[model samples]
Target: MSLVMQENLEGKAEIPRIINDGKESVEDIISNRKQISEKQDELEEVDRELRDISNELKSYDLPEDVDVSSLESQRSEIEGRISEMRQEIGRVEHEIETLDEKVDEIDEKWREEAAKESKHRTMMRKLDFVEDAHEELTEIKQTILAQIRENTEENMNRYFNDLIWKDEDYTVELGEDYTVSVYGRHGDNKIGSLSAGEKQVLALSFMSALTKISGFNAPIVIDTPLGRISSKPKKRIAQNLPDYLMDTQITFLMTDEEYTDEVRAHLQNSVANEYLLDYSNEVTEVKGR
Candidate 1:
């Protein structure tokens, strides 16, 4: 029985028996040491992690006199302020959106106004051109009218001097309004002071000057040619008339009171025909001489 028990113990104690052998024990010891070195490296890594966690905890450590309640209140106030700022940001964004819309509307209006301005500018240019043309035409009209006034005035003076009794004592002026003025030797207007005979002579001179300048060769007929003239003036006028009207055909209708013997003597050489009217039983017949 003791032997059987010993045999069982020897089977359970095989590891001890193997440890007693030097080569097998040494191999087992080397393997165990490698496992221990691996475990030690793992332990060193765990220790470094623990030290890092402790250092982080030290950083989070509160001071002895730190106010938790005040910090909590400040944090709550900061959160409230942040919430208000978010609301303000939302309102500002809304306002910016409205302003952008307004800006776009203004840009559209500006484009329409620019188009109208372009059209108005074109019309203004045309207006300027028309105004310039009108001004040029007005200037030309004034220059032509001025030239006519000057020529008429010169011709009036020449004919007036030749026919008038006091020839060298008067100057005639023609105004822009076609009004005639006669200035005497003393530069006084003598038109209102002239006698009927002088006035008639002046009218005849003016008519002759107009006929000469009219560029028309039509025959002139004068009724009662020397009716308002004195005897001496009528004789002088009759003498000068044929010479002055040399190129024109003129007929003078005269009465017995105006066609005196002296006037007829001065005008007989220029007279082509003379006529007498005989009235009987309210019937008149013109007989030529």
Candidate 2:
């Protein structure tokens, strides 16, 4: 039974392929990641604000002397507006989370079928009539599995190394589960774990790496990445981001406090565009200044 399963898996799986066009420009890669992260963050802020507005309508109360009917009508209108915003926000958020899932699906199908073709390459090498197709199938599956493992390892390592944890870059595990295990630095380990900030960075970093390695084009986006960090680290992030992520276009969505002039100057040369979003009566608008 195990052999049969292995045969089927190999017969339907795909082999590994890596880029040979030379290493990608680190600058372009990081810039793209930043663009995507910023856009996603913008949508998230809008979604949260809409939720708060919806809750405000639900909690509205008027004085006894006020026109109850008119007040109720106003509240209802606000509620309807929030509902509309929620629908739009939901759609946008879904697209962000699944960003390149469709691409993955398409590539996965191709890889599975390519595994079968690889066997033909081997069979042609051997002059013997390959009647034992199962032998070939098993080999293909192993090859495909090995490829997947290698890709995941490389993808996890690059970003995990950038983590600011005290531990020596060992908290990351990309073998079985997409889980990050933070361990103590060369001492007694108290259950390994990734902090919220570390996990966020790892996820963002992996997303960027996967897109680049998979040969798919995507704009990098990072929203409120410093939400978990202090002003000091945030400043450090602003100063060195472009150095690590050179040419990648990035969009950084941030609060005013997080987007101070000092921070802006640090990233000015790296940032292609800067935007300002301000709240207005019954409407919020995007402005580029």
Candidate 3:
């Protein structure tokens, strides 16, 4: 086999080999059997005619007034017919024997084919088992994902509530697709309509909730933290984010304007391993703070 076909086979489950090639097809075998049957029927008809001729000869009676010459002529003609009928019977019997031999050969092939068919059925059953297992695994995976989403949704709303100080009536919705939306007292507040500060806050809350529920331990990193938001929302996020992500390590990439003295004070006790990036001679150096 080619390397590709071999690799494919290695990745797949074992199945029965097909044994249908290099032999007459089932349809052809059936046609041969039908012909044999037809010939046998013809043979039977010929035998019946032979028996009828014998019966006619035995049951024949001549009138006492009939001439002797006429009787002999009639007997000769009857004998001639009987001879011809016997010859036909012999030919038909020989034909039937030849047909029977062919039928036997075809029957043996059928028996061998039945064995292959049995293997094919077994393989089909194995395939059905694999299909059933896949379906069950898919259902289990969906169930787990649904439960994770539910927990994520709960966590998202909780974090959103803590971060969003002004919008107490707003609720966070986490879709199965992991898209986050905020619902206000009036209706759904579109993410596109939110101010930059609000978007940052929402993103922080959503990520915190997702990380908390995902069951994977990883560090949280945010680039340009609170860079786009106004002063009020910036301070709010700076105060809340550290507490929300207390369980995981967080790294912040920020500009001087974004990381104010007040925000630093808010994170003083929780902060660890702070660094500054200093550019000199077309290269940046990491400086410990």
Instruction: Report the Cα lDDT for residue 251, model 2.
Output: 77
Backbone clashes in model 1, listed as residue pairs: none
Considering TM-score, where higher is better, how would the candidates rank from best to worst?
3, 1, 2
Per-residue accuracy of model 1 over 1-289 as CA lDDT, tens digit each: 3443444444445434433453443454455455555645655555565566456546877777877567556556655555554555455555555555654655555565555555655666676798899999999999987887787778778777777876466899987787889998889999999889888888887777777667676899999989988777787788777776678899898899899999888888888889988789999999987
Lowest summed-lDDT stretch of 10 residues in model 1?
A: 14-23
Show pairs that collide, candidate 3: none
Please report, as a residue range, the 10-residue window in candidate 2 with the lowest summed lDDT: 16-25
- Model 3, position 36: C-alpha lDDT score: 53
Q: In order, what is each prediction's RMSD in angstroms?
A: 37.0, 45.8, 10.1
lDDT digits (tens) for residues 9-75 of candidate 3: 5333222222232133344545555665665566566557656755765687756775656645665
Better of 2 and 3 by lDDT: 3
- Among these predictions, the greatest TM-score belongs to 3
Model 1, residue 197: what's the lDDT?
Answer: 85
Q: Per-residue lDDT of 33-54 in model 2, one digit per residue for the tens?
A: 5655665566566567656755
Native-structure RMSD, model 3: 10.1
